[model samples]
Each structure stands twice: as structure tokens, then as C-alpha cells.
Target: MLITFKSKSSPEVTMYQEHAERILDVLNKNHTRGVITAAEAAHALQLLEQEVALSKLHPEVDAAHANHSHAHHLQDEDETAEMADKNHIGFAQRAYPLLEMLRAARDGGDNIVWGI
Candidate 1:
């Protein structure tokens, strides 16, 4: 299933459940659908935007992600793709627009809602 994240301050962003769950997990939130307060959204947005810089400051984050991605020992093409998907590089690239939307929502004091 797909999840549609909506905020009155910006255009909506719809992503597959897997992608959404990964993003949510990065924010240290439960992998479930619900409303996110403006404050929470702001905090998450900051982290998402600073992913690269923060990765430098906190090597453990990158290490954990690396370890998780490499845990799959399969050498098949699909497994390779899965590893790539779990990597922060591609996630950061794809998350730009989602972060922008969250920023607008935060600035506007609007909550974000999904799974509706």
C-alpha cells in the first residue's frame, strides 16, 4: 500500500509504504500511520535535511546503516538493489521534496497526516 502525507502548508507527497516507513523510522517514530505535530515534523525535517552533515558528525548512524545493508549476504541483483535501497545516499536524494514539504508544514504550524 501507498501512504499519502498531507499538510495544509504544502503539496501532498505520496510514497510507497516501505519508503514511508523508512523515513518514519529515521525520525525515531513508530512505523505506523498517524498525525504528526508541527513540532515533531520540524524536528524530523531538520534531521532529514541534515542527514549528510549529521552523518559526518555521527559516524555511528552511518555505521549502523552500513551494517544493516550488508547483513544480507545474498549476491543476487535483487539483493543488491535492496542494499542500495537501504543506503542513506539514495534515501537522502529521494527525500528532498518530502523534507521541503515538512518544512513548509512546520513553518505554517500545520500538522502532517498520513494513511487516510
Candidate 2:
């Protein structure tokens, strides 16, 4: 299944369900239909940014992803190819689009919502 994130400040960010759930996990948010209120957006943005940075510096840190890579083949062919050819699409890459949305929401003080 696909999950889409929306906010007044950013374009829609659509990702696989597993990917979106993982992002929500990283944000310490419930992985259900929900919203990150304007008041909470800044903190959520910070948390995700921190997790992304950590994943970039320590690729081995995301061990859960190793067991959860069943969806790897289902992702974009270009992305899969890029991962094989060069950079591994670790948590950092997977979380980038949502991170951008978080950043936008944080700056604009807009609520970020998903599963609507």
C-alpha cells in the first residue's frame, strides 16, 4: 500500500506504507491516520533530521530495515538501480521526501497529515 503526506507548505509526499511507517516510528509518532500539528511540527522535524543524520553516519544502525527489506524490489526501479550502482537507500534516502515536508511544515507552521 501507499501512504501520502500532505501539508499546506509542501507538495504531497507519497511513499510505500512500510516506508511511511518507519518514518513515523522514527518520529515517535503513531503510524495511523494522524496529523502533526503546527505546534508539534518543529519537534518532529528535528527528530527526523536527527535520525536521518544518524542513519547517514551509521548505516549499520538501521538493523530493523535489514529484516524489513521485502519491499525493496517493489520500490522505484531507478532508485533500486541507483542503490545497487552507488548509494544504498538507507533510512536517510527513504526519509528524505518526508523530511522535506517536515521542514516545510515547520517553517510555515502548517500541520502535516497522513492517511487522510
TM-score of 2: 0.78
Tens-digit per-residue lDDT, 6-110, candidate 2: 999999998888778878887777776889998998888889888888877876656436334643564775555445445346788788888888888888989
87 Cα displacement, candidate 2 (Å): 7.9
Question: Against the true structure, candidate 2 has what lDDT?
Answer: 0.77
Off by over 4 Å in 2: 63-67, 71-87
- Specify the highest-lDDT model's number: 2
Against the true structure, what is each candidate's TM-score?
Answer: 0.66, 0.78
lDDT computed for candidate 1: 0.72
CA displacement after TM-score superposition, residue 40 of candidate 2 (Å) = 0.9
Give me the displacement of residue 6 in model 1, in angstroms. 0.6
